[model samples]
Target: MSEPTGVLTLRLAGPLQSWGAASRFARRATERAPTKSGVLGLLAAAQGRDRSADLSDLAALRFAVRLDQPGTRVRDFQTAHHADTGKSMPVSERFYLSDAVFVAAVEGDRDLIGILHAAVRSPVYLPFLGRRSCPPSRPVDLRAHPSGLWKALEAEPWQASTWVQRSRARERRVELEVIADLSAGDGPGDAVRDQPLSFDPRHRRYGLRSVHSRAVTVANPLSAPRRAFVPTQHDPMGLLED
Candidate 1:
């Protein structure tokens, strides 16, 4: 496989994030992590690109997601009446990841990735997690890296919440899970139909994409015992100990 020239990292941290690839009417489901189609859509939205825009260029890029902090799955209920029927509609069962944090990376040419990175930082259209109702809690743009999407995902630090990070700090080693686009020679994984052919709502289309799961270990950045600072005046024994 060819090495990636550039990479764009996105911090997908939100109170309630939904990235459903196979969602149908009245039932919306979410994937464990962000989808490639969803991330591309986000980039396009940031660039103010319309749905009819040709995404072939964007879709060609490799995508990967790091499970920084797997949040709890919550089922939400909502009711919406038909537009023309004007009658009660079935309550939509929307699934979301509450307090989830993921690090998604895209590897591609510098020109394209650079444009996307800029758009992420300064999106023309407001960015949302998946649906418009589920906006990200913080900025999605993490930063840029020089490695490919897979390597970047492996190398990036844990993006979990402060509490989660602190809790993990007690551990001697931290292992993170990552799902990335599988190459020709890579190991096999479950097939998923998420590659977006087009974003046209009228006739949306998708293609099958293969992904493989793997784990990488990183030294805990915060694996240090917590300490409370004591003022010399408050602790006369501190001077004696010194």
Candidate 2:
């Protein structure tokens, strides 16, 4: 008998975020969206799990993210010196998403999902969007959704900021992109290497996971308002008295 399952949704919004699955050397790069490993790591941190802790159970949960407000990508450079040697290290370039918002969801056994929900509300360790430097602007927990992953994402109201929503007020509906784990019997998807194998720093590892992408349109809450009619002032000349 299979265990009953549920989905937990997280609101990942921040002033700056960096989710880099393939970052290396002095050039740390962030993916356009959050990675599965990054989101799972967040839950693990909420539970106060150590880096070396087994992640099989958490890794088994299916993952997905909705790009609510795709923020601007910006870069900065930093130079640091070795503490022990007092020698300057190489200049490093780091990238971040400014003012990005994402709705990340994971589906798993109901019992496990419940525990994660509780952990998120009062996490053992404070949760960050993707890195420690990028703290969430709002509470991360949006509660558990009874529906499935894709449906939950579609049903969730627009999470964009007031200004962002207002910026697109002219539109009646907005299309948001969703990226989710590919399941059996589904069409082919692009492969990514962000699946968590181990968070162990000594020997960190990852596996390939297939992900599918789609878009959902939701009503714009801040749709454009009707323009009020204004009586035109009579021209002083009155068109030269016609």
Candidate 3:
């Protein structure tokens, strides 16, 4: 079986990130990690591909993402009054993740991957999370991986923030989950409702796609720190006195 020789790796970390799967009116939700559509849309923005442009080619690339850190979910209430109607609008709950991080990989033709990587480095149009309101906090481009999506995602180091990394590094090892696009013979995975049909705002559409998930335990991806935290299960010394 032939596969793309290169995969584009990206660090999707930011103060606030949101990837909506099934958001309804007055209630905006988000996925734990970046979605295929969201990532691909970022690429398109890098290449300056308009919303009406052809996405079939970009969508063909194999997609995968590893959850380095599942940020905390926060909700904000939004209130507005209708333009025509003189009634106050319902309070909308907008959700966002704070200090989230993810390593997203796209496997495709080497040349294509290279181009996408460059686009990310210097995007033609600004790249946002899932919505324009949630802009990325840091650079999105990591580098190009000359391997399969799974290998790249697994090999890449944890992308959590420094403080978060230190907190987890005290444990010395962390288990991360990987979700990748699949057809058959790739083991069992959940079908996600993120496959993009059309990104048209007027007629947005979505479909289901298969994704396999697996846990990978790796040594603390962060390097040596000044101090390591030791969280013991039992209070050997009984430091807390009644």
Candidate with maximal lDDT: 2
- Deviating ranges (above 4 Å) for candidate 3: 1-4, 83-87, 221-242
Clashes of each: 0, 0, 0
lDDT of 2 at 74: 95
TM-score (C-alpha, index-matched) for candidate 2: 0.91
- Please tell me which model should have the higher lDDT, number 1 or number 2: 2
Give the per-residue Cα lDDT of candidate 3 at 166.
Answer: 75
Range of the 10 consecutive residues with the lowest summed lDDT in candidate 1: 230-239
Cα lDDT for residue 196, candidate 3? 83
Worst 10 residues of 2 by lDDT: 233-242
For all candidates in order, the CA lDDT equals 0.86, 0.93, 0.84
lDDT at residue 241 of model 3 (Cα atoms): 66
lDDT (10s digit) by residue, model 3, range 119-209:
9888899889888888888888888988777778768877777887777655677889877897679777788888887888788888898
For all predicted structures, in order, the TM-scores are: 0.88, 0.91, 0.85
Candidate 2 structure quality by residue, lDDT tens digits, 55-127: 9999999999999999999998989999999999999999999999999999999999999999999999999
User: What is the overall TM-score of model 1 with all chains considered together?
Assistant: 0.88
Deviating ranges (above 4 Å) for candidate 2: 225-242
Put down candidate 1 lDDT per residue, 91-129, tens digits, no spaces.
889999899998888888878888999998889998999
